[model samples]
Target: MHTRNVVSGVLLGIGVATFVDETVFHQLLHWHHFYDRSTTAMGLVSDGILHAASMVATVAALFLYADLRRRRAFAPRLWWGGLLAGAGGFQLYDGTVQHKVFRLHQIRYDVHLAPYDWAWNVVAVLLLAAGIVLLVRGRR
Candidate 1:
């Protein structure tokens, strides 16, 4: 598997996960918004921006993967690793940067955040560890 393929796959996974988060949590579940300081309208705008970015990323990744496949350089193991890593990284960023550092919004409103934060970060760490292991094993 080509290294580029792995990277591309990761990008795709990240984008997809982001889209899911935006659609499910932001719109459907109504748990939280991208920026809690603003109105719901602003929140929708933020979600639109996020959705656009995710679409771009997903398209870019697919294009790159197609190119690599045409060249017969796609590697399954490495690509899977990248996918796991990308998804995990996004979750970690959301937990640490958005939820904690930025004070944007918690996983839920008027509820205990410790459990949500702990679970989010822990799952992210596991995903990252699994990705690293797969990447290393793939290289061997």
Candidate 2:
């Protein structure tokens, strides 16, 4: 596999991990709370669904990038892979540091947070921007 394929795969993995936590662990298993107690019943609506969608989208993007790479659609650059990476990277960072590290609200809770929270947000934004640029530039 090429850089794009590798990065996309990595990102997809990370995204999947996040989805499992949000949808399965958080929603299904009731391991923890969501944004608030109001979101306790996410059967109708909640962030858990969004997390699953993001995972699917990122993985789909990676799948497309991989197919294009195999066909030499954009052999030189894997711009699309970057977006997949960005999405995955954000989830990974959010999971590892924000959730696992500080135990902040189980899932993403980086709004109106502290300096470190802002720092993480900035990093996630940069990664997403870079990934988007790569994906747009590499698209064939």
Evaluate all candidate structures by whole-model CA lDDT and list the values in order. 0.86, 0.57
lDDT of model 2, residue 111: 37
Using all chains and alpha carbons, the TM-scores for the candidates as numbered come to 0.94, 0.44
Which sections of candidate 1 miss by over 4 Å? none
Provide the global lDDT of candidate 2 against the true structure.
Answer: 0.57
**Clash total of candidate 2:** 5
Per-residue alpha-carbon lDDT of model 1 for 19-113, expressed as tens digits?
87888889999998887778989988888888999999899899989888898888888888888888888989999999999888788889888
**Each model's backbone clash number:** 1, 5
Worst 10 residues of 1 by lDDT: 1-10
- lDDT by residue (51-120, candidate 2, tens digit) is 7666686667578666866787544345445545655475557655755576645533443446544554
